[model samples]
Target chain A: MSFDVNQLFDVNQLFAEICEEDNLFAFEGTITSEEINTILENVEARMAELQIDLKHRKKIYNITVECIQNLYHHSDMVPEPLVEKLGKNYGQFVLRRPGNGYFITVGNFVLNEKIKFLSEKIDKLNSLSSDELKEMYKFILNYQKLSSKGGGGLGLIDIVRKSEHKLMYRFYPYNDDYCFYRLDIVI
Target chain B: MDTLSIEGTAKTPTVRFDASKGLIELKGRSIPENSIEFYKPLVEWLESYAKEAKSQSTVNIQLEYFNTSSSKCILDIFKRLEAIHKNGSEVAINWFYDEDDEDMLEAGQDYESIIRVPFRMMEVAAG
Candidate 1:
């Protein structure tokens, strides 16, 4: 099966649906650290308008930071077949309000071979109880060495733990050699 | 030794470590893309301070939030402070969070359990 957006996906329809979701912000294509910072500032300013308490505001903000950072850490160049349509390391992230809480959804490219490993990883994290999650977080914090990207593979753990909710995700085949890894966190 | 202070930014935290006064503080959000780079000086300062730290050193951490990358750097800071505590100086880590921020309190508890230094979780009234 192929995952070519030009034929298999409708970019305009997807973008239009995203627009109707009460989006606070959405960024497509290349995302850098500086760009992430700018988006964080924009989200913070928008959340401030809600006049909610500070604690919740900080949670949503922090989760948003982690979500966007995923782009920098996990984004892969689109497969050659899809490169012209998707560009290199191009991803889509949206912060929106669909229900009582905010939703942070991000979709980034990953090499197709990585899908199984990532799938099991997220599933393992999702299956743990809250206490187990805490233990895993500590174990990782103390024992696991930092990766080249400066993460101990704990971002998802921290995100899931903070939101105290499930880490919802999906994997869409973007091409023969790439997959679209989509993650959604509600806070 | 002189005091060390760095202003906070949208991506990094503010640090105030007064060597003579035995007071160390880190406040604000820490989500820098390269937290190791941002926090290298603070860690190095603490390493030097541990050599001749005062008899009683109080470290205050009032982070609104920090990313996972910053979490490791924060742990590094505590581990260095642990050296100071083990070296015979009385060290107290005061972790402050908004009254309603249970997650922040839990974060403090996690660090307290991990590090040997004394940790005081101070809850400020929510605004």
Candidate 2:
């Protein structure tokens, strides 16, 4: 059997690239519920280690929970043809402290058809003033039946309200029918 | 209707609903991935209790945190309770939020406005 030195170099390069943007933590792969548990605990522990105030720590934790679980509900597994090329079911989840507040970035594979709905959702949410967002949140809370995903867009609203900022989003075409949806929540 | 008590875990909340005593208490964090599974029974219990209630019920919610899915289920419970209240049964919901947690307080207020089941927001010492 021939040893592949270049493959090792390629793997190391990938690790370095992931580490470049997020020195704190970066995860890319299947995010089972069990994985979410461990990731949350580790994040909590890290925040404690950093001596972050409880309130700030919890805000970070809550936003992270919503972002990752958004994966469980929204992200489709990479189709078989794309698995070899894509590496995982979802895109990378990076938590980093670039300057002041923490940056949480999560990406996943979403059907191209969903782009309009998602983009419009964010656009409408962004258009609202803080007061309007609260009213809209309550209005949706009162009327909307829980979607099959078990939430009626409350995750997005919560993310916006907690961060108190517009969501930064990007859709990179993954293939003919799917696109990689990346969301950035800063807090 | 009987009392329903479910112990809490890192991911789920503790529920204490005693029909006999007219006391309903939900404390601890509720972030269960399948909130539907965790909250369905409680909602059903409230539905059943609403059928044969003879006294005032007090619901005490002192949650540190809960996720979006749990929010829907929580509202379901509140709506059921509102039905009970509308049927001439006295119902009071005391929403307890940590003094420092405005998000939780706002959540309780949002529920209060929508449920019509008179909510009292109380600031409690952080636990």
Candidate 3:
């Protein structure tokens, strides 16, 4: 099967759709390295929109990059011919100003079987305190033994640790074989 | 043995290390397109710095945030610094964290506990 590049991707439209709502600052289509750069540029531009200092901007920028990359790396679409022909698998990310801090949401499709494991992992992560999370991260780093495409077993742990709030996620059925997983990390 | 300084971008952090001044600073965000490529030079510079560092050196880390891959690179940096410190030169690491940012503070403590260098945890007012 082939997907039209134009129908599959529209960077500006995605950005506008994400930023159109009140309190929304920026957005990006498909979390690739190039997309990451554009997101960073939009973030630099929106620093003034959000009226935040350079340090805050820096932190937010880092958090957004981490969040987006997680989406890119952990997305369910694999190295398949169709996805490759489509150029990229699109994931949605949004950063919204929520009072004192920003709320970040990144979502992409995942295989149905992965949701249970991910949910269980998040539940375990959610149960831990910061210190416990650190300990768990260390243990995972030393013992997890399996490296993702990014060579780190600590992505979810890092995301949970960085965000002040609990990691929120949703799973929506995309088809019989896959479901869309949305992960939210508020910074 | 050589000093390296790079400007901080929205996605990547600013890195400044002067072996001559004994001051190494890593500031800004770090989520490089390729974490290995971005950090390779910095790690190599540190390896050389460790070999030829002066009597005492202090590395200051003021990263607002970093990704998981960058976290690994950071651990590698800290381990190298620890090695340099063990070679009889005084090494002190100061990690600056924003007030109320328990995450960064805890991360600093984690690195401190793991590495053998003398690490000081300092709090700076959040921006």
Model 3, residue pairs in steric clash: none
Candidate 2 segments exceeding 4 Å error: A1-19, A84-88
- The 10-residue segment of model 2 chain B with minimum total lDDT is B31-40
Where does the lowest 10-residue lDDT sum fall in candidate 1 chain A? A1-10
Better of 1 and 3 by lDDT: 1
List, residue by residue over B21-102, the lDDT tens digit for candidate 1. 9999999989887677888889989988998999999999999888898888899999999999998999999999988888
Per model, the share of native interface contacts recovered reads 0.58, 0.56, 0.44
* Count of steric clashes across candidates, in order: 0, 0, 0
Q: Choose the strongest candidate by DockQ.
A: 1
Candidate 2, residues B10-124, lDDT tens digits: the string is 8898999998989999999888776888888998998889898757999999888888888989999999999999999999999998887788888998898888888999899
**lDDT of every predicted structure (CA atoms):** 0.82, 0.80, 0.73
Ranking the candidates on TM-score from highest down gives 1, 2, 3
**Every prediction: chain A TM-score:** 0.88, 0.84, 0.75
DockQ, all models:
0.71, 0.65, 0.40
Tens-digit lDDT string for candidate 1 (A8-41): 5444345556667888778777778777877888
Candidate 2: give the clashing pairs: none
